[model samples]
Target: MAKYANGHLPARDRFAHWRELLSGTHAPMTLSSERADDFLARQHVVALGEVTVWPAVFPPVTFRRTRELIRRSDPESYHLTLMLRGSGIADWRHRTLRTSPGTFHTSDSSRPVEIRSWAERGRIMMIGVEVPKAVLPLPRRLADRAVGLPVPDDQGVGALLSHTLRRLVRDLPEYRLADGPRLGEVVAGLTATVLGQVTDGESALPPHVHRETTALRVRAFVEQHLGDPDLSPALIAAAHHISTSYLHRVFRAEDVTVGTLIRQRRLRRARAELADPRWDGVPIQTIAARWCFTGAQFSRSFRTAYDMTPGEYRGLRGGDGPGV
Candidate 1:
């Protein structure tokens, strides 16, 4: 991971420095900002193989890639932007899109595009990923349809992709440089999945990408319905319109069964609530039920996992009092 900041630079050189950095990190582009004279910005970049993830905050600015710039040098890649806290307008291929928080925008390096963004209150914050077009598993024609399109990141595959990007950025510090290629594969796979969903091109993805995407979707579903007692492999399969056996096969690569994954997540959630002081007044059984665990079963599982019963663990964590 690499970090860049312009706060220490001379005020007159801040925006210019920012422009140069952007050109190197992303593709060559002309940047203009009304606050150029005193632009304040910081960027964190993570290079995962051929794919690069950049999380940045900067003053309101307009970035444009002209035809001449494309002619001079084009990475032949697609740039995806996930807006975290900002509003922006993008113009590409004669199409215009207005984007806000929790939305996504895409542009092609081989094409001319213009994006003007402004902050809601503070600096505009967003995460951008540069994906080589050839690296995506989707067909060229289908993937091209997603370029210059603005989509919401709050639903379906988009939500999963958004979560993955944010988690990667947040946990980058914990990853070793040697993990780049593997991490790159994950990001690229999700990018393909998102583009496939957007362009109705899922049928074209390779088997491996399909399996990984399905597993990701299943994990997301499990997280959403963890509190439901009826959550099981059969229900999960039915929700995704796949057979139970197929669901098992999807998770085989993960080295854990679906049932185990659900149980582990539930136990983790229960443990967190038990240790939180705010839940001190809540009965242990009630807390257990909240996470779909019965009283006896909860105690046994908690003891097995943490080597302590729920009451003991709670007391050790400074809860108000222990519970049976």
Candidate 2:
């Protein structure tokens, strides 16, 4: 991840520095801000393979990509913007629309477009994903339909995509650079699914993308129900209205069975708590049970996975201080 802030620069030079930084990171564009005299903004960017996720906060501004700029160079990518704390207006293909928090707006780098953003109180904040056009799993005509359209993110697949992007931005520091390609693949898959659904062209996506999308949804369900002792392959499949055998097939692409994934995630959660100094007062059995593991089962599994008994591991981490 890379972070950039203009606060360190002199007030007079801040906006210019931001412009240069924007040109280097994103597509070339002309930026004009009423607060340019002392612009305050910061951005964090994470590169996932060919895609980049950038979350930024800045004051009111207008961004324009002109025909002249496109003539000079084009990244041939689609920029998807998710408004987190503000509202904006986007103009593209002779269409203009307003976007608010929990909504999405897209733009194509191959064309000229203008976007003006502002907030009622503080600065505008948003997450933007730059995906290569050629990598999109939809036909060009269908993908084009999504540009400049206001996509409501409060329901259905749009909501899932919105949550995924937001979570990625929020928990980005927890991920290593080596995880980029795989993470990028997941993001690209979800993005394709959302775009296809928005354009009423879901049938256009390849079979693998659909499988991956279903797997992603299933994993999210598992995460939400991790503490349920009854959680199993049958229950998970039933929740999604799919058969257990089919669920297994879906996870075949992940090279792990559904049950194993659940167990791994549960153990990981328990282990994290066991190692935390704040959890020192919590009993090992209680922590294990909190993650849906029986006392004996938790000890066995933790030793198998981490090569140490839970008590020993907790003691090593100072979790065995005084509180028992």
Candidate 3:
């Protein structure tokens, strides 16, 4: 199993560790006496780290000093974070951020800002990307404000981006260096899209790329919720905070219907079970029910999608399997 260290490390040491990683240099952070270690975990994905922390342990401790730390970190090189696990208040310029579950705050390293996590232990997950400023494509002022601010979780680009980030952190191995630049683009695009900052007259996006991103997200969502029989078009749409019509549009653009996609996915899973000899004795009806095919209708639907009945497929495998 992957090892993880959970606890605090002194702030100066933590700062120096991150600085060395980001700068690719040997300079160490200067600290008189600062302690800030909440929890740190080695990310499952390469080129990234997963950290959960509360504001009380943040570097510099004081708001003014924390601002200086941000400046030293070089936001252009690392994307700092504000994620909340518990209810808390964040004080950012002109904005009093109420950090609730699902709150996400990102800031550029160069900017100076004060953020306070609410009284309750507010938790955050930070994934820093080593990217240059030239590629960010946003004005400094806008970027500063946009960072450390809440982006609505209610769908459109934001939900997709949030889902992608969560999945990336959860399934990091699937990404590669070749994917880094493109991932950065998606990150910037979604950030801009959610912030309503995408300018007019920009070149049209490639339909294939657009379709691929959404399709990947749809597939990921399906895979993640396989056990939920109610994961239908309406539910999927709701999950993404998109209207059913818009969800259908996404499917239609990919040359499929929402219902068709779901059934195909269910049948494909059912077929694998029916074919696997290990499940031979686990009654065919039970196997069907396990995949959400609870009745004759589902059984018929499965047969129509795949040529063999579930029982026939299981029977052909022999009775060696006793349970799922």
Q: Quick one: best lDDT, which candidate?
A: 1
lDDT per residue (tens digit) for residues 166-275 in model 2: 89887887989999988888787788778888888889998898888888888888888999999999998888888988889989989999999999999999889888
lDDT of 3 at 92: 52
On the 0 to 100 scale, the lDDT of residue 39 in model 3 is: 26
Using TM-score as the yardstick, the better of models 1 and 3 is 1
What's the CA error at residue 128 for candidate 1, in Å? 0.4
Model 3 residue 158 CA deviation (Å) reads 4.1
Best by TM-score: 1
Give TM per candidate: 0.94, 0.87, 0.54
**Per-residue lDDT of candidate 1, residues 53-151 (tens digit):** 999999899999999999998989888899999898999857888988877888889889899998859689999999899897788887898886766
Candidate order by TM-score, decreasing, is 1, 2, 3
Global lDDT scores for all candidate models: 0.90, 0.86, 0.51
TM-score for predicted model 3 compared with the true structure? 0.54
Q: Which ten residues in a row have the lowest lDDT in candidate 2?
A: 315-324
* Residues 1-324, model 3: lDDT tens digits: 122323355533564443333233211223221234432322222332222111222222223225556545543532433242434444555566665545455544465444443323333334333334454444444555565567555455556666656665665456675665566566655544444332321223344444555665677688767768788988887876668887777887778897777777877787787787676667766776777877586668866876766665566756445432
Candidates sorted on lDDT, descending: 1, 2, 3
